[model samples]
Target: MEHSITVKQQEVQKRLADLTLQQSRLSMIPGFSGQINAGYSDGRTNDIVTNQYINQSIFNASGQLSMGGDIFNWFSKQNTIAANRLDAESNSFLLQKARNDLAFNVATAFLQILLKTEQVKVNEVQVHQTLSNLDNTKKLVIAGSVPESNQADLEAQLAQDSTNLVTAKNDVILSILQMKAYLNLGFDIAFVPEIPENVSSLPITPLGEMDPEMVYSAALTTYPLVKSDELRIKSADKTFRATRGQLYPALTIGGGLSTGYANNFYDRNMKLVPFGQQIDNTFNKNIGLGLRIPIFNGYQQRTAVSKAKVNVYNMQLNRDLDNQKLRQDIYTAHANAVAALQKYNASATGVMAAQKAYDFATKRFNLGLMNTIDYITTQTRLFKAQIDKVSAQYDYIFKMKLLEFYRDQRISL
Candidate 1:
């Protein structure tokens, strides 16, 4: 997940760089352009003074250097630059949100592995207890203190307990594999989940007192996903303004230095003028400002303005949707956290009761007062209670972490 997030971050960074480049290009002052041309021409004309037909051929060359810049269009250029800058900021927030989501996923997967490992431990303890009970029952039967059928029941319970333990171990392996998959690691990974040995000691905000409204408000301001949406809406607004600027008259100031040469011209001595002399004689300079008022352009500008408005509206809707989702997630996580905590507490009480009952049953079974089937039933109940406790503990932890995630806070064990 980390590796994938890094790759996505780089992509967002590249987009930011491109937007920055666009901003720089748009903000720059307009510069000059140069053009040069050479050509030959042939023509015929009647010389009215001589009243006769005449023909002449001329070679011509011209060069011009001009400078121009947009004077005014209601600040369209500035608005475009602003829009691009906003887009870059939006992507930056988007990248952070992506990273946060990936981190949350990894944390959730790690918690699952921890829970499965604890279940495996619980299963091991159950197996050991069943094995001990089986040995005691066999000794009792050998001494003729208990029936032979009692010993047979003990062996059957032992087999079942052993199978449960194996299944539990397989669950641990599968959970580890799931975590590895989230991390994008290979199956051969030597994965180990780090969790507090005493989860009850870990400090967590009590869900009963947590205010969903407060959390949602904080998330609206601090969460990158929410912030990204806000920035996108701002970008769309700027773009819309820029697009509307196109409807106004555009003005540009321009200046040019131009010269031309024609070899068919005559000097003072009635000779064809030299190229250099012709250029100097024809040199021209001018400065002017141009304005364009949009009368009609097949409604292109109107269409663009309408589209920009729609974009802004869509972005606003998206932001609202994100906020709604965030609220739903926080509320749901808080509810789950509360439920899980209740389950954890109930499971703890059940474990105590089952333990006492199992202890009593074990003594009775040894003295041949309780049958093998009854003892096995009590032992399985204890195992189940322990398993439930482990599950509830991890479930509460994950739900708490999920709430933290929505609050734009880092999740920790």
Candidate 2:
């Protein structure tokens, strides 16, 4: 999705390009200009009147070249460039954070599919067991060892188990679709994620003992999102400094050269000057410096500076907020991992106990010492215990992975 969809990645690329263009604009030579003009006039315009000593209409050609730099404005321009560069760097990190976030999301969705698939298998096993029990009960009824009235109840239980299996299969399908949505895959694209045959359980006590503060500190140094926030604060600081430059004066120096030809000017001999000689004789040069003091700009500069300062403050708060969130998430994940581990252990115990009870119930039912209602109830409890075990096991694993993620660890099954 990050590489192909390009929904988020293209935005980052565009921002980077914009910043780069701004940097280029800032580094450009301050002021360099040249111009050339050629014209023929009947001396009708006041500015192009024929020379007073001559009577011919005016014909003129001229050119000029000038170059200069804004010494004072350069400071502000360079500072603004530096600020934009920092912003671009921050966005680079943000892009990395975005991709990381996407990976985590996809991983979570994939885990959901795996969990749901396991649930479907569990449901299938329960339905198979229910059908077997129904068959044994039917045979018992035929042999007159049990009442026929029990067959209907057994058949109904079998039907309920089969319905549950169908629901479980649909759950798996829904989870798969959710995973596909995360991948930005088309509905027509079929996908089946690879899962290990078994996932070994990890000890949650050590994870619970881990310090959230330590994990948060590690994450702040390691995670791109944390680093991106820090960079944003720095970028805003630079922008604030750049905005202060508008309060200062701007200075520049430049010079120009120009020559013109006129058909009207006369030489020492009192004859009309040739166009080439007129051009040589009418050449001129000038050099000067300029300074622009910013008396006032309707408080626009002040407003910009104030806004930049506020942005800096906001960015600082954002960084702090991220830190707080990281700490909270780490603590929450640790707590959930501990709780899930306990639940899983309890479910495992329940499954064992239920298995024994179901075995006993089976023996009793086969011997005509137990009723079908009680046997079916025992079987349902056993199935529920097994499902709970699966749920808790996956829950614990996911929580543990979340804690690891907070510590800047990769999440993997």
Candidate 3:
């Protein structure tokens, strides 16, 4: 999950949320600024102590420290902080949703590998069966019981079965590669996924017990996507309130400490004052409160308020859209699950009947009552039925897993 790109993207969102919350919290606190300067002046006009204009070269140093904070702004700062908090909360849910999605994707890839592996096994069996039949037909031809044409046909069938087996093995390899990609693993790495002996034995809720509406209702409460959207709407509302507060009057408070030093400063005796004394004498402190009534600023504040309001509406609409999509997905999954179950049942029955026909054809062929064409046809039918049954079984299992995931917010297998 950590290696997945989607999961990493969600992690970045979480980091952004932390930064936003930090910014919002900092906004509620006073901001401090300070500066220090030292300069040499070629000419000076005034003497601090003498209170007279003079022309002389001098060196001066000065420093100031000031802080400002919003005393009032219709609780704009509070609202902004609240909005950011909500956004952070929303990101948490989004992160979980990403993880959930990654988990589901990985599970799907794993199941694909399993299905392909099963297919390879089935194809191997078909190849072995064809080879055995070809060997028996060669013996029969030698005994003058069957024609050479039967042996040629069996060889051709063996070639086709071998090709299919190779293809199925290639498919398994491709599926394993896909699984590795999902895990962000190197293709060259030696890996073999552990396969369950009986996938159909995995626990799953019966389709009859899982109503689509009930699943949708459960997902609405448990799904991270829905929770994230709901939180985003709240966050957007807070943002709107904060933005609207900009249209109101604001109050602020500030204070500063300043001091300066000059090389040329004199007392009443017309003697130059020491740098330390000059600095002490020049030291000053000031404090003030400020009020800014928003009169006009090219409609910037109003524009901001309008945009924030629109964002709130957009968030609400997004929530609705997400809910609607979630409902549609649940219903679609339910339908697919029903269809997969039916297909699996039918395929199981078909495999049984095909197996019986193949066995009868095999006995008849050995007794010289069936021709090569008829026996080959029966074998091919059985092969197809087995392959279809395997496909249907895996498909049905995956569908059921998906439904259970939607209903419970977790996949277990």
Candidate 4:
């Protein structure tokens, strides 16, 4: 049992690893950069008109203090930031949804294994009872009291029952294999399902006003896909605003070094007027501000802004479609859960009645008041009732998990 427990724990841990995980954080860390640019006019003459007597050598030294966020760049940058934030949120919600779905599946498989195990046990009990009856009938045949035909009939019934028990055992094995695989267990592992006395009765929660409007309201703020769509819409809206801002004037501000140096300096010094002649310059320093304005872009910005708005519109459409689909699914799951609960109650009562019937049939068979056929029929009914009881238990559990999933409730095993 300890080994089985450890194996089960390890298996479940593997399944948990597969569950979708979500996290919240900024993708891009804020940063800054520093750079330097220098120009040297070793002996090149400027375009300035000279009297030839007033010699001049241009040694320009300046640096630009401009941010990447110009009127055009600002919109793109804002859009990118918005997209990153939205994408993060979208991914988080989607991961949460996937995890919830996996949790539901895990609960479902566990319950199915348990229910199938109970069914196999009931079948085994029925087979054993039939075998006992056959043995009793054989003893009577040896005394020459009961007819050999009765003994033959009992043998035939026992053979059929033994075959059914074998089939039921196989079914249990198959169920365990499927459950183990879902739990991420090794292929050679097996689980012996442990049953509790009875399932706790679930409270009756009315699905009265959970219509499209309610479900949408619940899902929009809850469901991962819907939340992702909402984030996309927000992202698109922000991107459109940033894109439109691109058409406006851009502002930049920066102040840094402006320097150039070679060897010497003078008033119009190092002057060599010959074309394609090599010369060296001295130190020069200067600082200034620069501004650029966009007069027109062949209407490219206009079209780009328009395209961004269209994307926002598309995202809105997606949100509406997702909301409608979510409502449909929630309603269906609610119905299934309610129906399963009803079946669970009915099956519980059936198990009690079938148990009493089997007990009475056993007493009658022992007193010779009931034949082997009658006893076997009673056992068959009891076995079916036990199957129903287990099936109902699992059905309710599965459907309940689905309902909880739509409601964004925490899952339990």
Which prediction has the highest lDDT against the true structure? 3
**C-alpha RMSD of candidate 3:** 2.2
Clashes of 2: 0
Give RMSD (Å) of candidate 1 vs. truth.
4.8
Q: What is the C-alpha lDDT of each candidate?
A: 0.82, 0.79, 0.91, 0.64
Residue 390, candidate 4: how far off, in angstroms? 1.8
lDDT of 1 by residue, 1-413 (tens): 45574646656685875668485566558778999999986778544345566786667689999988888879887788888778788777777776777788877777777777788888889878878877887888889999999889878888988898899889888888877776778888687777667767866777855778888887888898788788889989998999999999999888999998766567657677788887888899999999989999999999999999999999999999988988998888888888998999999999999999998988888777887788889988999999999898888888888877777557765
Clashes of 4: 1
10 residues in a row with least lDDT, candidate 2:
47-56
What TM-score would each prediction reach against the true structure? 0.81, 0.84, 0.94, 0.64
Report the C-alpha lDDT of model 3 over 193-224, residue by residue, as the tens digit: 99999887778888898899999989989999
lDDT of 4 by residue, 1-413 (tens): 12244344544543443332121112122223445555555454433435343334454433332223232345556566666567666766666665655566656766766666667777777778778877887887798666677677777877887887788788778877776765667868656666655555544234454343565466566777877788889978877887887776765433343334322232355454332122222223333344655679898989998999999999999888887778777778777777887988899899899899999987776666777667777877887788787788777777766665566545655
* TM-score of candidate 2 to 2 decimals: 0.84
Best by TM-score: 3
Order candidates by TM-score, high to low: 3, 2, 1, 4
Query: Residue 92 in candidate 1 has what lDDT?
Result: 76
On lDDT, the stronger of 3 and 4 is: 3
Report the poorest 10 consecutive residues by lDDT, candidate 3: 42-51
Inter-residue clash pairs, candidate 3: none
